[model samples]
Target: MSCVFLALKIGKVNWQPKLNKAAHHTSDYCSTEVILRRGQPFNISLNLKTTTQSWDNFTFIASTGPSPAESQQTKAIFSLSEEGASGWSATQEPSEPRCLSFTILSPADAVIGRYKLQLQVLAGNKSSSKVLGQFVLLFNPWCPGMF
Candidate 1:
């Protein structure tokens, strides 16, 4: 008798959402710290790769405020737009490299803190949350004034 064990595939996280690769920066516990300036346009591409099955529906949600993982007090910042970036949100993204560019417009009154990022991939009834942990949303105010 031969044993046949079919291995399953998982999704991969590509590109830094915060768009910075700082050394020894382990705040979110996954990728590097993401620096988001206040009232700035955060346009980033969320590149993903599926190994096994095709995606039927995909959704990406970000945090509006800083919160710990598995906490029920997480606020939804915004959903990733399906505009451009290979149109991964409109169709079942194949097993190739899927690209979904998300533009997070940081409100002027937005809180500056570490926010978590969650990606939901669904194939029929089965779904998975590829939580990339938290990234630092920095709000720096530097003005050239007299010291």
Candidate 2:
């Protein structure tokens, strides 16, 4: 139900390897490359440090598909409070990583491509979105061999 992916990437970068915030995700490798099967939810988790008082208003928007909502690769807003528990809400902490979980779904003919992650936190009446990290969706190699 709840898995962690820390292998993806945090923020943007070209082919070159630049240092940035270490993205905490459900994947163990990083936040760039992920292998999944068709028609299944690739469970993932990410930890984002925040100073907000409440995690209820925190949300994350991830774009795994090149196309918008039509490509079956699009994702909706994932609430950190709804997914996992962040000490920020329970206790008045300065800043802590809000652990959130979500699933990335690939279609039957899913093309191996890049998926980006963006985190959004809402406080009072204001909201903000930021590019947190990214990951690659690869075809599952355990698929039944064709005859």
Candidate 3:
């Protein structure tokens, strides 16, 4: 399931952040921040530096909302690594950045908010494309609003 959410607006109301576990293939994965009334849950991670090519097949799909031509209900839930031959690689040369971490789930009622975290990177075809970056989901308004 591909679901990325981070909405904050305090003073009015609008907060959404939930993505409890991520990191399947390789690159990098870290996104955790789901604390409505406790603590711990705020670590969004995703790093990539591609240029390597040749390709037998290397897939990395991650989506939440928007993009994908502008959302069609948004769907990007992919996790595959451990195929074979060092996770399959052809070699175009240009590797040095790879990280992915995700963990977010704030549900207790959640209210006092502000968020908008989006990340994308799908290189399955199309001669290989890239666009990995997106962030925004702050918390700490005295923290304590799960309702």
Candidate 4:
């Protein structure tokens, strides 16, 4: 059996949603990657700064494969922040960094080879993407104790 892991980080501490003429806004988003040993658990942290009472609807997508165009063997999406507004909504202030993490269950018959993991961030309908932040996996079939 083999395992996978992922980690994430944004480039800046202060981020504001870009507003359109009607004042509709969309925040900037980013992603990171992590590698893990088979059967191990992993964690990821997300940080943001905003004046809104609360940031809501932040989204994340996770996929595994050799490339983006190829089929992903596994995938998932979830929210990164809670709802409600903070007291600093009227001023420019940095919010505390938050972390979101999940575990991967390696396939019972995982093959020994290089695999790819991709993470994408979506704000409303817009999409921002990132690749592996960690090293690639190398599976060895010739190790001792192998049949």
Error of 1 at 39 (Å): 3.5
Higher-TM-score candidate of 2 and 4: 2
Q: Rank order by TM-score, top first?
A: 1, 2, 4, 3
Winner by TM-score: 1
Kindly report which residue stretches of model 3 are placed more than 4 angstroms away from their true locations once superposed: 1-38, 51-97, 100-111, 117-147
Over 1-147, each residue of candidate 1 has an lDDT whose tens digit, in order, gives 011101122344444443433321323545435655544444444444432333335565556544433244345523344433321122222233445444544444445577666666655456556675555665445311212
lDDT, candidate 2, 1-147, per-residue tens: 011122222233221122111222224455444433443344444454422133455555656665746236455445543222321111122322454444434444544566666666565566566675665655554433411
Please, what are the lDDT tens digits per residue for candidate 4 over residues 1-147?
011111234433211112211121112223221223332222332342222223333444434454532134343343443322211011112434342332223322333334443345444555545542432222324323334
- Model 2 per-residue lDDT at 131: 75
Error of 4 at 118 (Å): 2.6
Clash tally, candidates in order: 0, 15, 35, 9
Instruction: List runs of model 2 lying over 4 Å from the truth.
Output: 1-52, 65-67, 81-112, 141-147
For TM-score, candidate 2 versus 3, the one ahead is: 2
How well does candidate 1 match the true structure in TM-score terms? 0.47
RMSD, candidate 4, Å: 17.0
Encode model 3's per-residue lDDT on 34-97: one tens digit a residue.
3232122434443433222223333334234444421342333333333222211111223233
Candidate 2: C-alpha RMSD to true structure equals: 11.1
Question: How far is each candidate from the true structure, as Cα RMSD in Å?
Answer: 9.2, 11.1, 17.2, 17.0
